[model samples]
Structure formats: structure tokens, C-alpha cells
Target: MVKYSEVIWMLVLFFLPSQAWAQQKVPILIYHSIDEFQGQGSKELYVTPENFEKQMIYLRDHGFSLLTFEHWQDTSKVKKPIFLTFDDGYKNNMKVYSIFEKLKTDQFRPTATFFVISDFIGRSNRLSKAELKKLADSGMVSVQSHTATHPDLTKITNYKEELEGARDAIKSITGKPVIAVAYPYGSFNSKVMEEAKKYYSFGLSTTPQYYSENGLKNELFLLPRIYIKYSTSISDFEKIVNGG
Candidate 1:
């Protein structure tokens, strides 16, 4: 006769692999600029508007739900929730708004998250406060913190100014609670994570790994993202989303 402990062990062995195999892995695609670089810029940081549009259209036709950062809280609601996150809030990111407008559907709403440096707003190429507000109000984009000055959080001396300050400033401008943060240069530590928990509900990193709901409880602050470079072809893009 099998003991209760033996039965429990057997059940665990049976379910663990099934859960791991069937687990939903959501891809959070990270992008920097959505414009053509005339010259003198990292190619990895730029994705031409034409390519960006094609990517969005491909996601639309393939039935992938483009998610906002807020949606990260409850992945159970959507079947294929993929996040399109733009870092550094360049003025060119406004192009994403137009692209999303063209691709909006009843089942597949194209929404994205913009991680802006709060202290750099209204600078020459960065997004101004008004533009950030406009994007936030549109119901298609989320304005989140990339920190007040976009410093490496692990090296910062003032955690409050870097973490809380950015959250407060963006919340004030967008009139929405700043619930998420993307680390600058994808840098962080236990110290950063401890401080981040005080203000943010979610944290993002550039680890080039896709996130799944099953793994999040232990790794919320270290959630990984896949980088989408300018040279990523349509075939590779499809594979990236499909977890190939």
C-alpha cells in the first residue's frame, strides 16, 4: 500500500513537469528608439519606423496581445500577453502611438510601456511632461520610471532620490500610480530590490530571457526582457515571440 507521503511525492513528480511544460512564457520585448539613425548611434538601439510597424502588424495578425506594464500583475487574464516596452522615452517614441492606432483591434489592442527618465523630461530629445501626459491619457501607453536621472541603481548613493523620486514625479505627471520600474542599463542588486519594493509593484531587467507567470513569484524584481535590435529579421521576431 502506498503511504500518503509516497502518494504526495508521486503527485508532485507528475504535476511539476506538466506545469513546467504547459507554463505560459510571456515575452517582454525591449526597444530603445523607433527611428532611423542618420549616423553615429548604436544600431542595436534603433529600430526603423517601417520595421516597427511591420512588427506590430505581425503581432496583430498572429493574434498576440500587446500588453501594458499594468497587465503584468495578472497574466492569468490573457492567453498570449506580450509586452512591448520602449526605454529612454525618446521623442520619436511618439511614432509608436501612431503605429498602435493603426493596429488597434477588439481582441488585440496594441499597448506599450515607456520607461522615461523623469529628470530628463523636456530636454532636447527626451519626451516633455505634456507629451508624457498625452501618451498616458490615451489608454494605450504607460509612463513608468527609468529613475530620476537614469543612473545605475546598484551604484547610486541616494536610493530615495533615484527610486522614489522618479516614481513620485511620473505619478504626479500621469496621475497614475507608478507601479513599475526598469533598471537603468539593467543594473540592480539586493539593495536596489529592497528599496524598489517600497515603491514599485514590478521591476524589469534586460536579461534577454522571457518571463512566465509560474516563475514570477520568486523573481518579480528581476523579471527578464528580450532585446529587440534593429537588425532582428521578421523570421527571428516570430521565433522570439513563439519562444524559439
Candidate 2:
């Protein structure tokens, strides 16, 4: 005979949709310079502060939310969520910080990660240790590791020195746990991930895609990120967050 408990279980299963391995596709956008054409590839990584404001505004007005490293990572064995990150410690990021302070709302609070090079802090055109530390203390920014020398980790001869050294250096300055990493030049390999696990909770890459449970089993290690650019229009920005 069908008991009340058995009947309820059957009804729940019959009505509930399958969510076994399915995960929401979240974009982790990557940006580099927030100034004029200063880096390689004709300033591809650089986006003007004006344009940056527009993009942030676009995310604000739209339903898209800014996610932090802590937010994107899983706590209960779930897949990672959407994230936005910047690399290579540029000075103009302070402008982004100010804009975030003035414009962000509770519903639109912006969360971002900055991957900084340990040795390059306070070198001139880059952010100083004080600036980076302040941002880290703000509790809004997730300051992660970009290695001490910004070398391609996949090609490095010493994984322990490259991976652990950067984590240690950042923790010293920020007084926060450096749990995430962005590969210098967006480079990574299986062996690199193997060694990286010894130090980081997550790592990022420059690949143009989103994270899902069905792919990249180390979803934590090899997360894909969208490249925000100078020429990106509002429509293009919409398309990116909407996964176009």
C-alpha cells in the first residue's frame, strides 16, 4: 500500500524539474588598463574611465549584478557564479573605485577582483602598495595574486616559488587571504593547475566563455572570463552579460 510519505515523494519527483548537473552560466569579465593605449595590441586592454562608467552604469540599470570572488566560488559544492576581474595593477582603477562609490546601489552593488603583480607595486604608472591595501580593506574588492614577476605560470620552472610566493606577498600587504589567481598572460596547463591547487581556491583565464558544471571539472581552476574593451558599445556590453 502507498503510504503518505511514499505518495509525497512521488508527487515531488513528478512535479520537480531535473537540476542534476545544470548550472547557471555566469560571465567573469576581465579588464587590464583603465587608461589610454599604454599596453600591447593597440591598447586593447585599456578602457577609458568614461567608457568604464558607461559599462558600469549599463550593468547597474540592467538586471546584471556584480559578483565578488567569495560570491562566485562555491560553499556547498555548487558550481561557481559570475565574476568580473582586472589584472596588472593599473593606477586608473582608483577612478573606477570612486565611480563605484558614487553610483552603486544595494541592488547594484559592484563587486570586482584585482590581480596585482607583487614586485610592480608603486613603480610609477601602477598602483602603490598603500592604494592596493586600502582597496583590499574596503571589503568590496577582492585582491588576488598575479604572481611576483607576472610570468606565464605554465612555462615557469618553479611552481612553488611562482604560486606560493605571490600568495604570500599579497597576504602580507593586504592582511587578507589571497584565495584567487589570474594567470599572467592568461596562460595555464594541467600541470599548472595541479601545482596551483596547493595554494589557491580559484584561478582565472582569458578564454571567452562562462563557467558550468558540465565542463572544466576544475571549474574553480580554469574559469573563463570576458575581455572588456575600449571599443565595446552599450549593446555589446549587454550582449556580453547576457552571454551573446
Candidate 3:
């Protein structure tokens, strides 16, 4: 028997944007230090400059559009936008800028977000004020809050000190409005999300998955990002970017 409701459902599905039908997935890749530091720390956090360059080159050759976290709202213009974000503001993050300079093309402009610890700036192995200003001024890099001391949001006693406080500090240094934050330790709760709304327009989390405009419809604040670690090989990297 023919059903009127079935016909209407089919029409609605066909008329929606392909994003809904195809379930488009965008990879927001998260990185840390971009140096050859193989000492007594989390080795996973370090991706050698050579490997980083290779990854960026792969993206360029593959026709993926690179974007910073700030461009989340520019959905109308972006085509297959892939986010490259670095955490913890390590001094070696400048290597990111260097690699981008080498790979810039007429069709692609390299862009990334650097989530920094406001309290740790200017320390050994951490980004200094001068370095941060240079990266921010380049217009290719975005300096965002990773909390004032990189504390776990779920455990923090004062949200204002860690969240809004870091936003202000980065703004003072970079002279740009701080509108986003990558939660420290990828930790957040209902309370954290509530407070984050008071300061930031975008809140990035460390959950591992592919993001898309459709996904952002609900989970923009708790957006998931794929971690690019030292051990990530070329094949796995392809899978991550492809939303496998």
C-alpha cells in the first residue's frame, strides 16, 4: 500500500543540503610541540619539524582548505575546511609558521590556532611575548586560551581565573579579541560549559573524531578534534583526515 508520510519523508531528505545526506566530516587536527624534542617528556606531544612539514604538504596536495578556529562562522565560503590546532604554546610552535611559509600556494593560505597557557608565557621552552606577537600578527596563526595555567576545567576552583583571565591576558598580548578556548586536559563539565559561554564564543574539546557543519549544529562548544601525535604515520594520518 502507498503511504503519504513515506513520500513526504523522501522529499524532505532529498531537498536537504548534501551535508545532511552525505554526513560531511571535517577533521580538526590537534598538535602540540613542533620540534625534535625527544627528551624526558610526553614524546607523543612532539612532532618533528620534518614530519610536520610533510603533513602540511600532504594536505596542500590533497586540496584540503586549512583554517583557524576563528573561521568557524565563515561556513558559507569554506570548502572542505580542515582545522590545524596546536596546544600549549611551545616555543617550537614557530616551526608551524615556518612550514606554512614554505607551503603557501595561490589557492591555499595556511592557517592554524595556537592554544596557549597564559601563565606560562615567556618561560623556558614556552612561547615568549615577542614570539606570540609575531605569530598573531602574521594573520595565519590564532593565539587562543588554554586556560591561565592549563588546569583541568572539571577540577578548577575558579572558572574566571582560568577561563576569562586567560582570555584577557592573551588579548592584552596579541591585541586581538580572544574568542575561543581549547579546554586544558580536554576536561569540561556542564558547569564548565555554562561558565565558558560567559567569555568565549567557541570552546574546543579534545574528543577524538571528525567535525562537520552538521555536527556543529549541536556540539559546537564540545567540538571534537583528532590528535596528531609523534607516532601518527602517513597512512593513519590519511584515515584521520578522511574521517575514518
Candidate 4:
């Protein structure tokens, strides 16, 4: 049974011109922890579990199509579509996965990418190989790399171990092709970009801007993303979607 709101939302999305969101870059919101009680990171990064659910509800009820990292390409003609990404392979990310599982649907399927540290897997706070494989096998979610030890990519002396090791580790665990690498702590440089190219198709950063085809004169490795903190109000979410 379709709800009246769902019907209206779908109508608006299906009828809108694909180019309508051209001026505004599509938002790729980055998250860290999804717990009720705060952890070690900045409080702002810890979007409460309640707020997380509210956000998913808002996105679903308001016509937003949640695209997976691989499926993000399907949103070419639509506006207000967003990519939800999480980094640092926290054990608590399993909690976030549960939230997404509860919200799954055909049209409004929520997609997420977990960028994990290769060395952290099996540790107390990181995901194990089996867990990584499970998430990747879901086909709706992707398990990518942060780095082998979560080092600053730009600061590393040997680029090979820093970048490729993580790529290989994730591939071996998930048996999925690893294409994207999110910069640890959003740190990067030209050297980092060059190193990233050897192993990845996308290198995401912390800059909060919409992704637009028009302004991307640089290589695809320097893809910028929006940091979605607890402080970001629903109005801010609106602006992010509309590319304001």
C-alpha cells in the first residue's frame, strides 16, 4: 500500500527535469559515528541515533532517493539525491547499518560506503573481514579504503604502502573492486592525488560542496564532499540538497 506522501514525492521526482539540479552540486554527506552516546570524536560529528533516524525519515518522506556509492551514477538527471558515506571503520558503524536496514525500500533504498582502515579490522572498534564481506555482499553497500593504518596520505613517505595496501586489503576481504579512497582526516596534496590515481577512481575530501560536472576541470581523484555534523539543521540539509 502506497502512502499519499510517497505518491506525491515520487510524482515530483519523476516529473522534474534532470537538469534542474545542474546549478547546484549534488551533496555527498559524510558521517562518522551513529550512536546515542557520544564517543571520542568531536561531538558535532556524532549525529545522534535519534537525529539519524529523523534524517532518514525526512529524506524518504521528502522525495530524496538514497543512492549507493556504486548506484550514485544513476542520479544523473535528478536533484536532491545524496550519497551517504562513513569513514574509519568504527565497530559502532554496525549500528548505523542496522538503521539503514530498517529503512530499506525499492525506490528510496539508502546506500552507504564504509571506508575502513585495513589494520583496524578485527580490533575492538573496527570491522572484521567477515563483516566487511557481509556488507559488500549486500550489493547496496560498499566497503572501500581509508588506508592501511589510517595515516595522513599526504604525509606518508612511501605512497605505495599507504594507498595500495588498503586497496588490496579491502579487495581481498570483500572480493569487490575498490575504486574510491576517502582521505584520512581530509588530508591531501598533489602527491596524494597522484598516488591515489594508481589505485582508485575517486578520492573524497571534507569540502562541503555539491558535485557538479561543470566545474570539474581537475582529475576525478579530488572529489570533494560535505561534512554532515550534528550541528547541520534540517534547513541546512535543504540547502545542501538544492545546491545552495
Candidate 5:
């Protein structure tokens, strides 16, 4: 027989909310050119290969589990789950592959999502079809869609071409399911979300916040991503991932 005080304690424990034990804040970091900035494009968009390597090392040393959107369900299951995303499929992003290779261990297997522009493949500065396929097949990167021409989803009238067409193109190249789309310029509206739902399981935006489930409608389609830019120092990266 339990005492009255023990019975009261058991009742409180049984009624505790499950959310209190669930992982809430998940950092979804976005990067573009993971290479040195030339005079050609925005300097802020370029995170140097050295700095990118340091950031990954920090994550590895600090016990972070690097993830792609393919492992999204594991966010609640894994310890310190975070998503690394790259946009535009820049040719320089191959540096990221090299860095991940150098840092991978049995304990730390780095993975990321490459949101590639379907029609821009094989451009002088973008990843060619063969290169994109290589990365996708490496089992370290998930190739997703950034639309056929990187058009702002909110302003586009041809939803089928930009959304479904882009998804199909990436699926053909990667031979893997294309389940996510990062909106060009992080632009989207209600119509965009509706169209995206038809093609993607998740939709990413440049909203600069860690993801926390809020029970909102279509919340998966409105996922927010924080930019990991050239100036994002290790300390800043630490703070961002730590939910500070």
C-alpha cells in the first residue's frame, strides 16, 4: 500500500505532458557557395571552405547529429539533431563533399541537402548533371528541388513546371525521392504552399529561426531555415545550434 503523498506524486508523474520530454528546437541551417568569394557574386553568400570545415568540426566535436530532410523524422528520435542545407547547386559545393569526407567517423556521419535548380544544371558555375548524381548517390547528400529556373514561387503562375517538373527532373537524375523544395529567394504564399504540397513533403524558407512544432496548419510546408553565412563564426554557430 502506498502512502497518500506517494499516490499524489505518481498521479502528477502520470499526467506530465509528453512534450516536456520531446526535442523541440531543431536548427535548420542554410548555406550557398561553400567556397572562397570571388568578385563575381555577393560575398555574404559565400562561406569559405575553411570556415565551413571548422563549423562541421565544431558540430562533430560537440556531439551534433548532422541530418538531411530525409532524416527529418529522426529529429525527435536522435540526440542533438540538426539539418544542413545548401542552395543553388553551385559547383564549388563539391568542397563540402570533400570536407564531409574528411570529417566523417563512425560516430559522426555528416549529411546535407542540396537544393538544385533543375534547369540550371550543367551551367558554367552550377553542378552538372553527372556531378549532382554523384553527390546524391554518395549517400551523404539528398538532392532536392529549387525549381526549374529558380523563380520566386509566390510570383510564378506555372506551378506545374516549377514545382512538379523540377521534382521529377531531380528524381530522374538522383534515382531517389525528391521530398523537399527550398523556395527561390525564400519566397512563398498560400498558393505556393498549396502547389508545393502536391510535390514535396517539406518546404523550406529563409525565415531565420529554429524549427519548433507549433501545431499550425501545413507547418511542415512552412519550415524555417537560418542562414549560415560567411561571417557565421564558430561561436555564432554554437549559439544558433544550442537554441540561444
Candidate 6:
């Protein structure tokens, strides 16, 4: 006959790994600009190239796998999976491509999702059609919709134009299926999500938390992301990616 304490310990050993695996939190990091502060916009929105490279190195060195929305299913299968997302389709985001190229290794392949605002493309400060195509063709970036105009979705009545229209606009450029949308201003509501469902498989928000499954309805549309600010120190980055 086994001791009761030993039996409980055996049960603990049997269940813990699966339980922990089910609860694994995946970091979906949000970034805006990859250049130094020129005192133009919100300074926190910019993460310098040097610091960005260091963050990538930390992820690579620590066995993190960089993924795009295209590989969402692989998050559980890969070791330490994380998503690097750049919003606004800024022209400076090209720097991200260069950093990714420099960081690629046999053990690590860096990739990211650029959420491009449809109407803002080809603007003086935003990415051009040619640049978007180049990044998409390079296989390191997935260009998705940030809406036709960066508006608070909750306040907007033009769901078709903002959601489906933006999706169509981006797909026209990248020639890849536009399957995700990062809510402009990180704004959305039940109506917005219902509209999003007709076009997008995923919807992102600036919820400042790592994503974990909770069996909620439309949870994929409610995906959470944490911001990686210009002021985010290396230690803070490590903690963010490591789910600390």
C-alpha cells in the first residue's frame, strides 16, 4: 500500500507539466518607431536601433523564437515564442528589417508584423507602396492593416471602410492574405470585433499583458500586447519577454 502523501506527490508530478504548458504566456511586443528621439512625437514611442538590436540579441541568446501572425499556430510548438510588432507603417521601420537581417542565424530567424495604416501609405513619414512590397517579399515581415485611417474604432460608424477596406488595401499591396488588424489607438468594442470577424482572423490591442488562452469567446480577436518603449531598459525587456 502506498502512503497518501506519496500518492498526492505522484499526482502532482503527473499533472504539473501539462498544467504549466496550458498556462504558458506568450509575449506579443508592440513597437512604433525604431529610430532615436528627434523630439517630434511621443519619445516613448521610439526604440533606438542600437537598443532594439540589443533586445533582439537578448531574445536570440535566450532561445526565443520570433514569429509573425502567419505562424500563430506554432507559438505552442516553438521554444519561447514571441511576436515583434511595429505599428503605424513608419518609414523608419525599414531599420527593423536591417536589424533582423543582421541578427539572422542558423539557430535564430527574426521576423515581425508591421501593422500599416492603409490611407497613410506613401506619405512623407510613412512607408511607401514599394517599401511595403519589399518588406513583404523579404519573408521577414508580414504587413497587415492598422485601419484605413487611425481612428478610435469605438467612436467610428464606418466599420466596413476601416476594417474590411483596410484589409483589402493592404492585401492589394503585399499580395498576401491580410489576416490581422491592430486596433488604431488600441480601440475596439463588441461591435468592432463583430465587424472584424468578417475580415480578420486576429485582432490586436495594447492591453499591456502577455497572451494566454482563457477559453473566452472571440479571444483571438481580443489578443493582448505589451509595449516596448524607448525607455524600456534591457532588464525590463528581459522581464517583459520572460513573462515577469
In candidate 5, what are the lDDT values of residues 151-230, reduced to their tens digit? 87888799999999999998999899999999999999899999999989999999988899888998998999999888
**TM-scores for candidates 1 onward, in order:** 0.90, 0.86, 0.89, 0.85, 0.94, 0.95
Instruction: Tell me the deviation in Å of residue 33 in model 6.
Output: 0.7
Better of 1 and 2 by lDDT: 1
Candidate 3: tens digits of C-alpha lDDT, residues 165-222: 9999999999998998999888888788888888998888989988755544337788
> Top TM-score: which candidate number?
6
Q: For candidate 5, what is the lDDT?
A: 0.91
Best by lDDT: 6
What's the ranking of the predictions by lDDT, best on top? 6, 5, 1, 3, 2, 4
Alpha carbon deviation, residue 91, candidate 5 (Å): 0.2
Q: Which of the two, 1 or 2, has more TM-score?
A: 1
lDDT of model number 6: 0.94
Q: Compared with the true structure, what per-residue lDDT tens digits does model 6 show for residues 32-77?
A: 9999899998999999999999999999899999999989999889
Model 3: lDDT of residue 230: 95
How much lDDT does candidate 3 score?
0.87
Q: Give candidate 5 misplaced runs (Cα > 4 Å).
A: 1-15, 18-23
Q: What do the candidate models score in CA lDDT, each in turn?
A: 0.89, 0.80, 0.87, 0.79, 0.91, 0.94
Global fold similarity of model 4 (TM-score)? 0.85
Q: RMSD of model 4, in Å?
A: 8.9
Clashing pairs in 2: none
Using lDDT as the measure, name the better of candidate 1 and candidate 6: 6
Best-first order by TM-score: 6, 5, 1, 3, 2, 4
Of the candidates numbered 4 and 5, which has the greater lDDT value? 5
What is the alpha-carbon lDDT of model 2 when measured against the actual structure?
0.80
